[model samples]
Target chain A: MRKQWLKWLLPVLAFLVAFGLGRLDSRLYRQPIGQVIAVKTVKSVKTVDNFDNQDRTTTQEATVRFLNTSRRGQTTTITNQFTYSGTVDSPLRRGTQVFLTKSSGPWRLSNFKRDAIVLALAAFTLALLMLIVRKRLWFISASIAVNAILFTLATHIQTDASRPLVWVLFSGLAIVFAVVTALFVVGWRPVCAVVVGGTVGATALAVGLGYAIFALTGYRDLHLEAVKYVTQSPQLLFFIQIVIGSLGAVLDECSDIAISIMQLDGSGKKRFNAGMAIGRNVMGPLITVLFMIFIAETFAEAVLWLRNGNAIDQTISWVMGLGFAQSLISGFGIVIAIPLTSLLATLAGKKEVAA
Target chain B: MTTLSALALTLLVLMLAVGGKQGLSDAFALLLNAGLMILAVILIAGGFAPLAVAAVIGLIVLAVTIFLSTTDMNVAGPAFVASLLVMTGVIAVVVVGVLFSHTGGFGAEDTEDLEGFSLTVGVSFQQVLIATGLLSTLGAIAEAATAVAAGLIELGDDATAAGRQDIAQAIIGTALNTLFFGFFGGFSALFIWFAKLRYPFWEVLNDQIFAGELIQVLFSVIAVAATVPMTMWVVGRRHREEG
Candidate 1:
């Protein structure tokens, strides 16, 4: 009874402490932190465009208390300008902890210092994990920790490498991801070799097919350059996107197929047919799941482009082009994995009796 | 053929060959879902309240995906109820996350590409992010809920304590892998981008783009985890009332 009480109490206690810590952690920052105490719109001007997009721009005055640096407690009123669309700027709200930049006169709001929210959400997640997963929570936590370490290591390598190394590192990472899922989650048996091999082989063929088709098509209307935020070669970056994006999907489907097939008491042909049946059940949802993610990830940009007068098809090409390409490539990989994994799992596990 | 069209055609054919009529419906449903997405985007860009359009479309999309995925009321009924319950909680988390994170607008990197685009669309970017967050998790959360409900139903009259444990284990195991590896795989490029720019760790933590994605992924984990117990409770209650 006491242990049950402790389980519930512990997470609540941790969350409160973490929330307080996150709010107070502003003192640890090198950048200026401004806590909005008061804000008011000083002026509002309306702009109407030919595209039927009409919105107002506003200038505001905000009184803030400095929470960091030598001026730890100074209060000042800063002028801010923002727009309704918030394409570049949004209105400042009370109690928002904003990172400030000092250029010449008044300090400017750059980005929000959102550690409190990050910490609170993270703490909430951990608490839920402890409460829900309970005994086997260690497995989940350990995997996440390992992922963090590997990601950090990959980033460190990328920093020194002349070119972006996502394709290379994640190819290695995909292999690791597959092996771990097979070994730990799927429980490594000799048949897991089939799972790992099938996943990797399908990914290679799918990516290669995608690449070949794109190359043959001359990369036409596909706007690789539209990918945001990079000085690296966009083509290679797109390649990296396809490779990483498809790996999990292929692995998930392959592992599912391999496990289900190995459990069946039948000849290889029957096992393969049963595998196809199970694979068919999942095929649609798996393909659409990734595609929906891509669409949502790019939705805001696509909307903005449309509002800005870009045609629908043009906006799609510009904003969702890479995402669509990645989705299709991953789609190809997932379909290929169904049969490939079935064949491998059928051939590897158990002696077959003639039917 | 255009790259998008040609590739889409190939995918359709492959799905049909393997998945047959069921795969074809799956592909068709996906197309319909995409159409809904585009319609929602158009409505928002036409100056409708982003939140309202998102809310309505979110419901319809959920129904479309859930009801279409199966004809079994036994599965779809419980799955739909559990999903709506989970979505309400998820939306609350998302609203707070978006409000505090301030990741509404396009980041500085997108500025170059959006140079000539007008910024006066009159729609709230925060709401847009909120909408996107809702849409993004629908597939995952719904899928998880359905899987749980379906598994429990498949157990039929023998949903003993041990059987429940087995189903829970299988569901959680798959959820962890699907959510974790999917995020890792999807975000690898962004990680490299962060490294190539050589942003400091603190800056990366505070960056709107990276922090937003990381926070949402954590929420996805919580949502999927929550679905298991929620689903069991929902199914259990329905059974009691029926009896």
Candidate 2:
């Protein structure tokens, strides 16, 4: 009875703590650089239709109340124009909460109540996780939160550094992340061997294979359009993504292969053949799933191109090319990790026997 | 051949060499699944409702990938049901989160790419976001469900004395490790992209593209957590009946 109460209470407590942290984080970073105000729309004055009446841009007069800085609680009327299609710009309705930016000139609509909504969604997601997994929710949520913090810090450090430093920093961060995560999830066991082995081995293989593919293709098909805003080298960014993205699947595969081999080892069975069979069984489905993830990420873009009647080859080059390369690289990492992990587990088992 | 084609061919050869007939069949299923996704995309672009199209495509992909890849109906049937259930749950969470966040539509960075394209192209970007989220998550959900089901079934076959709880515990351990590490590694580049451009913390969190991808990851995590129990139940029940 008490245990049941704790299960429910713990998630609620965690949710409140997470919410508090989120608010504090926002407050610390919510800069007073510009006049930021929470505003509500007053009235819609007129509408101008453009591009054959397909797009309607509406002009609205809104009452804005400042949320931060010196003009807090000050209300003023500002005219804002936005597209009717809630795609490019958010369509405003009366009483809708939005952020207004006041610079040297007139105040303009910046974004809707996006931050509040995200926080709310995150809180709900946490609660949902707690309800589902009960005790394990803490570990999952804490790991994600910690990883997020580490990632943020790493990004900050990378951005402030130079080219080579950025690469070294991120690569080091990946290794650290892998080691820390392994410790947290599996503890000091044979599982840790598999996790670390698979993660490190897969990351190394991915980097090597990715570079080889790039060299072989003479770097002709590398997609640079997605990272135009990136101040750093796009090639480096691509490499970083491949290394990181391959981690999860590789770790997952490693766990599967390693665990299966451990089971065989415990039974004093033919470990090598069993490991090979498990590897063969896992590789196909794993590859298909990873490739599908890559495909799905690009699906919308591909559809947009197809809608525009673009040729299949052109669409493939622009939309699918880079994503495919990344997925393939990750898939290779996972496939290789299977055998590497099995070997690691087998060795660990032998060591146990010797002891 | 282009680098992608060369890579595909190379993967095919490697899989065939290593995995043999199973690898060949898996390769064929992947091709078919890719075709189905393309067909779904074409349908959506041709004005079909994005959600309906995504659902159909997801189901077909799950079937082809899980059923064709695995030989036994006992394993495939349970995996199929578990994946479908988890996929549905993921889609629900994503759809609700997306609708509330309104994290749909083009980003500020997308302006350069949209120079010639009309914003009034009449396609609902909101629906597009939903479809994209659903589609992106399907692979992870399917993979997790299939892994759990397959792992549990395999364990049951090998160790009849192992209870359902042991199997469940094993899968959950594997699932958590995979997912947490996966998120950390997979999203590193995207985070770096946001940082290199110096997108403010608030803006980074609020950006539609970033939010969409993050939501997809969260939904996948949820699906994985849900899948473990579901797979255990199915496989455990089967074991009991067989016993």
Candidate 3:
């Protein structure tokens, strides 16, 4: 009974705190926050673009009550122009809270205050995790917190997105992430070394192979322009991505397989076979999971292209190319890590070499 | 396209080399799943309702990924049942995320690329966002179900207090490693992209691209955390009935 409260109490408190922050955090913003009191549509025009696609361009004047800043509770009229496509701007409804961007003289709609949803969903996720994980919840939460801080800090530090230093920086970060992650999973043991080694080795091998392939091919048709926002080398950006990208699944699979193999009783060959079975079991899921994650990022953009009359092959070339290549390379890490971990297990527990 | 095809071909060969017949079949299933996903995209692009296409195709993709990837009914069957139940929940969560967060359209970063392209593709980007969320997390949910089921099935008659630990490990591990880090891999460029543009944390949180990615990652982890209990219950029933 006491433990029941011990579980529910913390999560309930967390939910309240997060939800409260979501609701009342508006005062903390430097940008303007406002509630839409009235929206009057001043103009509406239907138009056709160069591609013969038809859309309605509508302009509206919104009366906003500022909730924050020195102009608190003040009303200002801001003009909002939107299209049905909402590529850049979407129509706002009355009673919605939004962030305002200050221009030379006029206040514009920046973005919606989405933190409420993020925190609310976060609270739900935390509560569920607490209920499910029970005692080990601390470890999971701590690892996540540490990793997030480090990830953000490094990204902040490497202000130069295209700098050569990122190779050194993220490579170091990858190892730190893997080692710390392995420790959390396996927690300070001789086997920790094995798990960490398998992950780093497999990840490095996969990413290096990807690098070699891209380089050897002269980076031909790699479609570096999907990320055209990157003024410099998107390829360098991609290199850092896959190196750290493949770290997650490979580490997961390695630790899982290694731990499972360590717990079994068998000769080298028998354990190797057992390890292979376990590895194969999750391999399918891991591959699908990683590849699908890659696909999802670019899917919306690719779909937009296709809907706008771009051909499938052309869409693949420009839209899906980089993500696809990343998936393949990261996938190579996962498939190869199975045997790599199993071999480590076989070697580690080589008490009986019945081979 | 050529680079991707070549890279995929190399992965196929490597899968065969490392995993052998099993690898070959997994590769086949993966290719088929990819084809289905692309087809779903095409269907949505062809003026079909995005959510409906997403729902129908997501079911089949889960089926093929679960059934075709493995031969063991003991693992695949319960995994499939649990996945459907959880997927229903996942779809609901994603719907809430898409609606409330409004993480449906292109971001300011996309302004340059999307120039001259009409947002009026005849389908709602909001619906497209929902479909994307529904489809992307399908793999993680399905995989988590299978892993939990696999662990429990291996436990067989000895399912007891200790079995709980194994199930917990499988569930949390899947969430943290594959699904969560998969987010990192998935959003790697975007993260760098944000940093490159010097968007502060507060501003980054409000950005469309970051918000969408954030919501998707949360959806995935929530699905995973939920999957543990659902799979244990579903698979636990089978164990009880048989024993």
Show the colliding residue pairs in model 1: none
All DockQ scores: 0.62, 0.45, 0.61
Model 3 misplaced regions, further than 4 Å: A1-20, A40-45, A160-162, A228-232, A351-355, B238-243
lDDT of 1 by residue, B7-26 (tens): 78888888888888877877
On a 0 to 100 scale, what is the lDDT of residue B216 in model 2? 65
lDDT for model 1, on a 0 to 1 scale? 0.78
Pairs that clash in candidate 3: A85-B119
State the local distance difference test value for candidate 3: 0.81
**Residue A174 lDDT (model 2):** 80
Residues B1-243, model 2: lDDT tens digits? 567766677667766766789878877887787688778777876778888888888898888888877888878888888888777776776777677666667767666666665565455667877887777666656666676777676665665434544555555555555555544444566677787677876777767667666666666666666676677677777778889
Residue B201 in model 2: shift from native, Å?
A: 3.0
Which rank order by lDDT, best down to worst? 3, 1, 2
Native contacts retained per candidate? 0.55, 0.46, 0.56
**Between the candidate structures 2 and 3, which one is better when assessed by TM-score?**
3
Candidates' lDDT values, in order?
A: 0.78, 0.67, 0.81
Candidate 1: stretches off by over 4 Å? A1-17, A162-170, A351-355
Clashing pairs in 2: A244-B185, A245-B186, A248-B182
Chain A TM-score from candidate 1: 0.88
Q: Please write out the lDDT profile of model 2 over residues A1-355, one tens digit for every residue.
A: 6885565454336546664454334334444322224344444443333433244556656666555557656776677666644557665545455556667887766765555445655665566565555576677567667767887888888777878887888788788777776776677786686778777987697668767766787767656566433556877767777777667666666666766676664543467557767777777666665666666777666765665557776787787777777777776776667666767778777777779
lDDT per residue for candidate 3 within A256-328, as digits (tens), equals 8888888888677898888888888778778898877888777778878987889998887788788788889
